[model samples]
Target: MRLALAALLLIPLPALAGDPLTAAEFEAYAQGKTLTYAMGGQVFGTEQYLPNRRVRWAFTQDVCKEGWWYEEAGLICFAYDGENDPQCWKFWQDGARLKAQFEGDPEGTELTEVEQTTKPLSCPGPDVGV
Candidate 1:
């Protein structure tokens, strides 16, 4: 019985995943915005913002920026300047805050007071039953 209960708890719950965004809406939200990221007080600028609704973030390079991104399977995936060679980082957004964990990094940081040219974007739909 205990094993059965453990198995039940491990079942996939798709609805607990994030909300879906439309392509048009994503473009609008990300077009002029900026994503300021920091790791242990070391700051980096993800200065370009071009977005797709189904995807989370897009764009790249220190120059002309080229990448495609999305949040699925509990991971944030970004494919930049190439195919079959995507980079993924894990993340969670709550209310006005965002947190992410980079690969090989033991700690994650919450992005605070994140300013966008427009209002901040929250995760899609209602809260998951976390």
Candidate 2:
């Protein structure tokens, strides 16, 4: 069945899905949208992407950290206020959905976009009281 094996191999598999989105694609899709991210089916965080690559993120809380994203070496990286380290991630788009994989660590976190809306992310802003 050498011919059968060859035929099977020649049969084109369906177009491979889950091709990662390019930097421009990611920015266009994320901008002006508030996306809620989940991991292991539990809500992990939410981010509101604004104009000029700015963002605000909250981890299931009212407080938000101001940040911005930049495309670096085919990955999206974020820098937040008071956080010296920049977190990088790879993003993929499956149809209308977005997926994020943290960089550097082999077992780095994976976040799925569970919900999205045009609503701006709620933020208490900087602490006004001591």
Candidate 3:
């Protein structure tokens, strides 16, 4: 019984109708918005989506990174300017909210969109002492 239960829990969840959102669909939904993502019930970070798939991501630490996304093999992958490695994620639209699964994570990290707004993301300029 324990084995069966564990297996059921391990099964991957289908993101609405057992299909991930296509590139056009994802773009239409995400563009022109800043989305707050939560992991483990805590706000992990926020991302502001701009036109032409441009994105600015900031962690709770307040460090922002500029990047852009493209669809590859049905997964959306982001490549930041300073980061050499590309981060890929699978997105799902759950009703009015959205959910994302980080690719290559064995533990399955699911980030849920908790809040969204058209307001711009606050990114501070370089440090300059007054």
Q: Rate the local accuracy (lDDT) of all candidates.
A: 0.46, 0.87, 0.88
lDDT of 2 by residue, 26-121 (tens): 998999999999999999999999999998888996578888999998899999998999999989876677999998988778899999999988
TM-score of each: 0.46, 0.81, 0.83
TM-score (C-alpha) between model 2 and the true structure: 0.81
**Per-residue lDDT of model 3, residues 5-65, tens digit only:** 9999999985654268889989999999999999999999999899999999999767788
Q: Which regions in candidate 3 have their CA more than 4 angstroms from the true location? A: 1-18, 127-130
Candidate 2 ranges with C-alpha deviation above 4 Å: 1-16, 125-130
Q: What tens-digit string does per-residue lDDT give for candidate 1 at 1-130?
A: 9999999999987532224333343345456565655545655434345435222332222323355666555555566654666655555444544445554445543333244544332323354110
Give the distance in Å from residue 52's predicted Cα in candidate 2 to where it truly belongs. 0.3
Clashing pairs in 1: 60-65, 60-66
- Which candidate tops lDDT? 3
lDDT of 3: 0.88
Error of 3 at 26 (Å): 0.5
> What shift in Å separates residue 49 of candidate 3 from its native position after superposition?
0.5
